[model samples]
Target: MMRVLVTGAGGFVGKHLVSELKNRNYEVIAAASSSREDAAAGKLHGLDITDLAAVKAFIGRTRPDTIFHLAAQSNVMKAWHHPSAAVTVNTVGSLHLLQAIQEVCPGSRMINVGSGDEYGLAGKQGMPLSEETACQPQNPYAVSKFAAGQLVLQMAKKNNLQAIHVRAFNHFGPGQEEGFAVSDFSSQIASIEKGLLSPVIRVGDLSAQRDFTYISDIIAAYVALVETDVPNGVYNVCSSIPRMISTVLEHLVQMSDVDIRIETDVAKLRPSEVPIFVGASGLLEQVTGWKPKTVFLDGLERTLDWWRSRVGL
Candidate 1:
């Protein structure tokens, strides 16, 4: 079995990716940003990508066949609040990983997981953003991720290392925490149903449309990149179909058992948010034969169901 190392293994996407990789028969070494004690307890191996020496020593010791660098301070609002911390973890941390991989295991393939938010202002250029689009990262999170991806690609080219930077768009499903559109809507609806909160669903700019892929489909795209011989540089993982946030919340509310009222929450609104954000997956499909399988409506229903079950409805 091929040995694989996944950073940020305890996170939402990281956890799902680790499970999928293990299911596919790869020897997965789940390295979380924290949880080193878990390693002694037969759990996640702790790894702090921010520490250069630690990263180099770990890479030299394991020499994994592939490294999925998923560690990141992915929360936009949090990154906005703590810009320096975001840069430290996302950019500088990724730099540490790149240097360690280059010095210790130059042959190992690296998949640097990035965000579609990196195409910040470019979303205004056109709909269905592609890999060729110039990135204009608006927020700290986007800036950090873009810098991280750029570093991996540039270092890989110079060092002749096999590396891929994946710009994954909005994705959601069961077990997704709040602070995102779908999960927030689903959680509020569930809470309303369970009578834990009022029958009001507070929301932000629901008119803005975004590309969303189910979590399983997103995981499949990552697996495809690993299994296939994809060329270096960046690739986008997304569903080209654009769904307005209003429609998303509407569908989730429809799935709810209780009567709910939509309330515009000024606190939930983001500043200078793009009206529409979507991405094309033609390149990913053409190369790895990976395309989104779940319909948008179905994914929403599944997410609502998951929330419902969690809230005891």
Candidate 2:
């Protein structure tokens, strides 16, 4: 069996990825920032990527055949407030992992997960951003991720490391935290349906459009990339279809039992916002024959159901 080490294995996408890999009969090392004894227990291994010595020791010890570096400080707004922390965790932490891999597991194939926010403010160029498009990061999170991505690419070329950088767009599904827009909307809708809160959903910047991919699709893309013999470079994982936030909220309301009213909350709005953001996955498709299988409505329904179950509605 192939040995795989997945950082951030406790995260929303990381948990799903670990499950999928296990189902595929791969030996997966579920590494997380912290391990919960009740839920993760024996399966989860504690790993703080921010610590270079710790990262080096873990990689040297396991020497996994494949390393999926999904660990990062992923919140955009939070990054804005704590730029230094974001850079340390996202950029410096990535550097630590790469250096450890170079020293201990140079032959291991690695995938660094970057964000579509790396192409910030460039959505004005046109629809469907391609891999060749130059990244123009707008926020601290994007800047840090972009810096880490560039390091991955540079190390791949200079050190001849077998690594690939993935520029994943907006993705959401069941178990996602309320920090994201879709999850926030779904959670609010669930609370309203369960009579835990008022029948009003507070939202921010409903006019902004983003390319949303189901979490399952994103995991599939990662699996496909790891299994393939594709060249080392950056690839965009996205659905290429932009949906307005308002439309997504409408879908969630329709899926819920209670009638919900949308109310704009200035507190929820980002200081810097991109009007529209979408990505083209032509490169990923051509290389791996991977395309999103889940339709938008189906994903929305599943997310709503998950939230409803959590709220016992």
Candidate 3:
């Protein structure tokens, strides 16, 4: 069995990836920055990726052949509110991990998870974003991710580390936190279903369009990338088709049994939010022969159902 270490193993994506890896008979070791309780049953280790000495020590001890770097401060609005903290976690923490890997597991392979936010305003170009697009990060989150991605590539080239980068777009499903749009919408619906709140669904800017993929598809992309013999570089993990936020909200409303009215609250809107972010993931498809298989409506239904179950609906 291949020894695989997953950082941020307690997170939504990380949990799903770990499950898939375990099913495939991989010797999975999950590392959580906080507590390893979630992965404790699965024999996880607690090690903060930001802690350089701890990271080095852990890598030295376990010596995984493949490391999935997923730990990061991923709140966009929070990043705007706390730029320095975001930089420290997203960039500096990644540097710590890279250095540790170099010292203890020099021959190991790595996958650095980045965000579509790195493209920032470049998504406004109105074309399906390709890997060749020049990044123009508008916010602290994007800037930090872009810088970290650059560092990954630089380290791979300069130090001969087997590293690959993946820029994943908006993904949602079960286990997603409430701050995300899909989870927020589902939670509101769950509440409305249970008579906990009014029929009005509060939301941010509904005009913005996004490429939303199911969490399973995102995990499948990662699995394919790791399993394939593709060369080392960046590839997008996203659905090429983009849908308007208004359309998505309408669909969610249609799925519900209760009557709901769309209400916009300025407080919910993101500052400097990109209007549209559609990515062309041809590079990933070409390399791994993998494409998003989940339909948007089906994915949304599953997400709403998961929230409904969680809320006892």
Candidate 4:
């Protein structure tokens, strides 16, 4: 059994990835920054990537055959308020992991998870962003991810490490936090259905378009990358089709049993929004033979159902 270590194992994507790995019969270690009780309940090992010595010690002890680095400060709005913290966690933390891996497990393969936000305003030039597209990270979060991704690429080139950088776009599903748009919308609708809130759904910039992939599809891509003998490089994991936020909200509303109206919330809007963001997965498909399998509406409905069940609607 090949041993694999997953960072951020308590996160939405991390949990899903860990489950998939277990299902595939890999010897898996779930690492998280959670308390002892929470880690025990989730079957995770407490490991904080920000602490260099701790990361090195963990890597030395586990000696995983492969590692999925998914831990980071992922909230965009939160990054705006705490840019320094975001950079420290995303960039320096990633450096710690990379260094630890080089020293303790030189043969270990690594998957460095990055964000599509690295493309920034460049998406305005066309429909689907390619890996060749120049990165113009506009926000602190994006900047941090971009910097970290660059470091991964450089290390892969210089150190002979089998590391692949992946830029994931908007992905949502059950267990996602309330801050993301899809989760927020689903939660609000579920609350309204349960009579916990008004029929009005508060939203940010609904006109902004994004390529939203189901969490399962995203995880499938990750698994494919792990199983394939692909070269070291950056690949975009996303649906090529861009859908407006308004369309997604409308679909969610239609799925709900109750009548609801959309309301623009200035408070929810970003300081600067990318009007359009999407990515082409041709490279990923070519390398790993992976493509998104879920329909957009079906994924949305499933997410809504999960939220409904959570709120007892």
lDDT by candidate, in order shown:
0.88, 0.89, 0.86, 0.89
With candidate 1 superimposed using the best TM-score fit, by how many Å does residue 67's alpha carbon deviate from the native?
0.8
lDDT of 2 by residue, 1-313 (tens): 8999999888898889988998899999989888654253137788999998999999999999999998889988899999999999999888888899999989988899999989987887667799899889989999999999899889878999988889999999998988898898888888888788999877776888889999999999999987899899999999999898889889888887777888889997763356778999999999999999998999999998899899853
Worst 10 residues of 4 by lDDT: 34-43
Q: What are the runs in model 4 whose C-alpha is more than 4 Å off?
A: 35-41, 264-273
Off by over 4 Å in 1: 36-42, 265-272
Candidate 1: the clashing residue pairs are none
lDDT of 4 by residue, 1-313 (tens): 9898999888899989988998999999998886443432268788888899999999999999899999999999999999999999999888888899888889998899999999998987766899999999989999999999899779878988888889999999988979888998999999999999999987766787889999999999999987899898999999998888899999999998899998889898773356778898999999889999999999999999999999853
* Candidate number achieving the greatest lDDT relative to the actual structure: 4
Cα deviation of 167 in candidate 1 (Å)?
A: 0.3
As a whole number from 0 to 100, the lDDT of residue 228 in candidate 4 is 91
- The residue pairs in collision within model 4 are none
| Weakest lDDT window of 10 consecutive positions for candidate 2 | 35-44
lDDT of 2: 0.89
* Number of backbone collisions per candidate: 0, 0, 0, 0
The TM-score obtained by model 3 is: 0.95
Error of 2 at 258 (Å): 1.4
Error of 2 at 9 (Å): 0.6
